[model samples]
Target: MPIFIDIGAAYPNDNRVTLVVWGEHYDDFAEMINAVDHGNAWLSVTSYLEVYEGSLQMNSDNGCDYTWWTGVG
Candidate 1:
């Protein structure tokens, strides 16, 4: 199984493209976000999307409803 973390700005903003990272474990996936925040700057730090095993886990969207879905075009 794979876990993913997404970070970026939402709609109607001069945000950067969403950054996606993959890890096999949840802890690794979770910790990576902090590392990223420290190492770089996000266009929007107010929202984040996490997915585990191809399922949406947590989404704290404060912008234009940034959500992560699996294979739905």
Candidate 2:
């Protein structure tokens, strides 16, 4: 299975696009963001989205709201 990471805007006041990056491309993704920030004088440090390395998994078995079911019995 491929791993995925969630990335979202660091600041709401600035217009930005939230995206998910493949784990394999994480370095490239972060580099691009940095390049844009460095090249643009108007863009502030907080204008970029932060990458979340981890996620919370919710499952129905323990009072969680989510459930994943395989069709096999």
Candidate 3:
């Protein structure tokens, strides 16, 4: 089954923006990077849909995970 990674942005004023991103569909990572680089903070991932072999999988037991890195060195 294919996995998905949903991403989002949030604000300090309790504003939360969400986005749904599919796994293996990161052909536009550059755009996402640019968006975050422009001062947009990620809020949280709402949910994801599982897929497999170019098809949606119903009984997939996979889940999403996240990792963060500080840009400052």
Per-model C-alpha RMSD: 13.2, 16.6, 11.8
Winner on lDDT between 1 and 2 is 1
Mark the regions of model 3 whose C-alpha exceeds 4 Å error after superposition: 1-14, 38-73
lDDT of 2 by residue, 1-73 (tens): 2222212334342333334334554454455444444433222122233433343221112221111222223
- Measured with C-alpha atoms, the lDDT of residue 70 in candidate 3 is 32
Q: 1 or 3, which is superior by lDDT?
A: 1
TM-score to true structure, per model: 0.23, 0.24, 0.25
Candidate 1 Cα errors over 4 Å, as ranges: 1-12, 19-28, 41-73
Winning candidate number (TM-score)? 3
Candidate 3, residue 27: the lDDT equals: 45
Candidate no. 3 TM-score: 0.25
lDDT for model 2, please: 0.32
Candidate 2 off by > 4 Å = 1-10, 39-73
Local distance difference test scores for all models: 0.38, 0.32, 0.36
Compared with the true structure, what per-residue lDDT tens digits does model 3 show for residues 18-51? 3334445444343554454555345233235444
- Supply the TM-score for candidate 1: 0.23
Better of 1 and 2 by TM-score: 2
Candidate that beats the other on lDDT, 2 or 3, i.e. the better one? 3
